[model samples]
Target: MNTQSYMTSYEILVYTGDKRGAGTDSNVSITLFSKNGKQTGKIPLKNSNNKDPFERKQVDKFCVKGDYIGELTKLHIEHDNSGRSSGWFLDKIVVTDIFDPKTQYVATCNQWLAKDEGDRKISRDLTLHKQQTTTQKSNYYKVTVYTGNKSGAGTNSDVSLTLYGNLGEAGPMKLANQEDNFEPGKKDEFTIECQNVGELNQIFIAHNNKGLSAAWFLDSIVIEDLYAMHTYQFPCHRWLAKNEDDGKIARFLVPQSSTTETPQIRKHNQYKVTVFTGNKSGAGTDADVFITLFGNQGQTGQIKLDNEKDNFETGQKDEFIVECPAVGEINKILIEHNNKGLSSGWFLDRILIEDTQGHRTYEFPCNRWLAKDEDDKQIARYLVPRPKVKNNQYKVTVFTGNKSGAGTDADVFITLFGNQGQTGQIKLDNEKDNFETGQKDEFIVECPAVGEINKILIEHNNKGLSS
Candidate 1:
């Protein structure tokens, strides 16, 4: 158990000016400073969520880690005018503590980070609110690098890694903890400040290809982003030695979410709900529709389903995505429409729900009319999952040849054979005669599907009299 995991996190919201060309493609950097002279490294600011970032009127969410730096008093921001139209107009910056949202610091820097802008300077230092106080502290990150056990797995070269995420990148941070840092079949741990890299994605690890054992077999790298409370795993399991692995001294390893990896705690979960309408006539509805899901733990608030130019049409599957707090095993769903009066019912065939966090799918079948004048006259219904069949009910049809004595008077039975197994012999009984000449008889039987129907066997008791 690491006590560093309990450190608080700060959220930075950057607003791009609404003016045209206010967005920038250039690299942006920032540093946090306390009035007591404590300051963080110049952390690179990049948002992975936005491919074309810093767009006009856009707000980017980033998490910044603070090392004991209490009551932030100011921050230094700068951007390199690199890419096309890289001029960036600076709006106000709002920083808040994740643990205490009410504790906020507003730095209003209405300037530009462009060569041709106001001061022709690409950097500015903005102070916090006039009423706030400041102090000094620094955040720490625990980095563990593993050396492979293979022959000549250790490296004598200098190893460095840069943390990349939506918030920023902190590094090329040298991995020079001790003289025997990269020893084969060994692990080294070092604690450094990797101030908030929101949603850690990719990591760049490499060596300078120096020393006696410059070619090293790297196993993996693990970094703790206590600000986001996630331990990210960047598995290499390859050679970073120049003479090995395509003779490359560096490897860009992305984060893995395998069973061994610890995922970041998510505040909200997204659900994809698809409502299928019956193919029958008058199956669609014009009024707004809503649904509420009930699970073992709790229930979701009523959410409206609306998408596309037209939705909930006859013989159509209307899909909608909604985000809410995670719930337990889903058991039931409530679906209804606001439409009343004549012929306004919606014939819902079923509803399918998929939960990404739980990796479970739920199906609720309601093959009926949801109208005020139909069924039970109730427009709403609570439908539980009626599928995921443990046993399949198949309607078997038997045709009697149109010839003399073609009908079977004796008790008839059938055993269906499939790839999985075979079903027990089931009696084929009906309301009318068992089977008449030129007549087709249908019977329903329930059994586990043997997979593919390869063959079937039929038998009779040969009892010619009534029971």
Candidate 2:
């Protein structure tokens, strides 16, 4: 007696083919896949083409969503002993998704079983959780056959099981012990090689007599497809930086220029750099801008710059580079007027400064630095307090807010309260102003804090207060 097992949300596909010749038997029973690797749900053969010499049978059992256990676990194909003949045979047996069976079959064939002609079985038994018999030996798998409705009943056949890489090609099956326990309609078992089983992508089971395709009783089958998850890099390019507030560039750019010309100077650690002139504010033409790169003891590297004169746009940016000297010391960068053209009276806007002073070379995070003004004035840094999730839930309390701009008078603070308790304050606003905002915001406190919220008080240094 064979018991079938089933899992949730799975469908079983079974194909049954022709029973021709004098000793053909069309009685085949397919089984469900068992969680224990044993056949479970055994369904009887419903459709048949008795008159046709070539008969192919197929059945589909779909389990309800999340009902994986109802899927087939085991299949039992029994040949009637009373009507048995000498030349009974079985052909290719396949189990797969009704929509896609190719991928499953190919993947299984290449991974699990052997690749031989007379040693491979066209039909597979998915009921087995593990390839218990097939993968037992070091480089070989075994197949055991039983007889009739009885466990150990019936006689063994004199035939052998063959393995194949695909359904078309012959040989290359790489199977051995082909003549071991050959049983047809009776209880029998045998082993096959496992070396060249690389092409078995899916689960397939079937049997054949001699070298030709034959029809035999078959049971249940199951298949699974596996995929590898990994991370890979592809080709991509970086975009040019627009301004200091925009973002930082991953790499520096090289400009085309000659030794006689001077280039625009950029501050260290700054992502954005723009230049403008006061003299020729409108008459756009090539102006001589002398750029000097100095190293230790007045030493210098390459003086690279663009040959084309800059038009000095309000927001446009260009690329230029300074090479480091062999000595590797603090290098001073200066930009002067060589030709002193009409637009030589230009001024720098977004002057980013990079730290090339210390012995250790470490580029600062783009957000940490800003351009300097006439008196070397830098932008003020503001802080924004981030709150943690409250333990006592207040579904009504909303914490939507923002921080003020640098130098702006915005006092940032959070007025948190619970129950009838005094309000707790957390400040994140600038000295000049409290906070910035596009619209209004609110928050709700949980039940435990509800009674303490009524006595809420606002604590802030800068900016105004509102209810």
Candidate 3:
């Protein structure tokens, strides 16, 4: 509950125990204060009058709540034994909303000791071991340390450090040497390259007095491959977007112009629509464009395209990302292009869809349907979280033919069933069922939460089907 809100509640738990001798009774009290140490409230737990060792008493349970924002609060528990011994036991203390746990700060130590306006310190404590024979691999591992002691001469006593590792089965390894050290008031760094005895998981570091004091510590027990993980370049923060215009001019759309050239597509039951106009020709025209997509059965979602509404211009190619305020299964999208007898045409290239985490949309790897839809599956579906953004829906696009693909059209759709009703289905027609050569289809579904969409099923119901 330690939040930025101007008004918040504070909760705490106080335990009290044994404040008497082996034969007398005791008493205890609890007090609460504001972050500035101002007394706010107090409560008495118990008072004893007996004098037996087994007669010593304790406070059962104490709870308190207070409004504390932009300040620190304190709790003081006291025990009084006017006629008995003088030792009190505090079992536990709990504080609520003390600090924001989600704050992103480079941790110098796994357990932060302190951080504030002028000074900060991080530390680690670990143990390393060497081999029993000299025949081992290069008896050493590289230790990299990062510090933020910039603009101040760095000192070691204030930064005590120690290294303990296994030697050739004789004794623990201690400061073989200080590879590099800097004075106080300056940015600091150090590297202790040790003999590789398999791996060194722990490297203990402390500041002040060489290694005597435990004031500052830094430890990184986890070994990570800093170079192997794949890094992705987000084309732009606005990959998937929502606009109320024709559903075209997308990150991946067909290059074309004109409503007569290609029909603009819309979701079956919702406000969502799609306009396809990003052809490889690089001409940002949409006069001859048409769009198509499978509609969910309930028809509660919306879809649209903006081939021209965005900052699209001629002779320039642009990539876009889909944005959704919710999460859902998006399985169909289609678009078409014709001159509408205008004698002018549009063209298109590739299309893709990915999740919020940037992982393209493909069902879970272990999904059973993966094998069945192998021929019509796409590797470019990425998930998005809903309700947090404006357009609370997913996005889709059409590739290949307006309503077809290599062997089957790539339209998408979904099915829904109300909480108390039976199941239903939605199908992406045109390209989804079957499309002309070289066209793509895209669509989206609003999946803000489980309450938004009861169920979703996608299919390519081509015109040739006999339902």
lDDT of 2 by residue, 1-467 (tens): 22543232222333333344323334445444534554435555333323432123322232211222322334334333222332223343333321222222211111111122234332335332221122211123444433233222212222332222211112223222445332334434444444332222112222222322222322211111111011111111222122212222122222112232553333232111123323323322244443333445342322223436454443344443332222233334444333334433233333222222221221111122112322233322222212222345433322335544223234444444555332234344223222234333343433223354554445445533342
Model 1 local distance difference test score = 0.74
Off by over 4 Å in 3: 1-31, 35-56, 59-64, 69-405, 412-467
Candidate 2: residue 209 lDDT (0-100) = 29
Error of model 2, residue 89, in angstroms: 6.5
Q: Could you tell me the lDDT of residue 247 within candidate 3?
A: 24
Give the candidate number with the greatest TM-score: 1
Summarize candidate 3's per-residue lDDT along 1-467 as a digit string, tens digits: 64643433232333333433222234545454544545534445432222222232332322233343333344455445444343433433443332221111111111211221113321122111111222332222223333223333232433322222221111123322444443322223333333332212122232323432212222111222111111111111111112213222122112111224453322211223212224334334333332232323211112223344442233344433333222234445443332223223333332323333322232211111111123233312222212132223445454553333344533344544335321223344433443445655565544322234466554664523331
Q: Candidate 2: worst 10 consecutive residues by lDDT?
A: 227-236
Worst 10 residues of 3 by lDDT: 232-241
Native RMSD of candidate 2 (Å): 32.6
> Which is better, 1 or 3, measured by TM-score?
1
- The RMSD of every model to the true structure, in order and in angstroms, is 20.1, 32.6, 26.9
TM-score of every candidate relative to the true structure: 0.31, 0.20, 0.21
- Candidate-wise lDDT, in order: 0.74, 0.30, 0.30
Instruction: State in Å the error of residue 50, model 3.
Output: 20
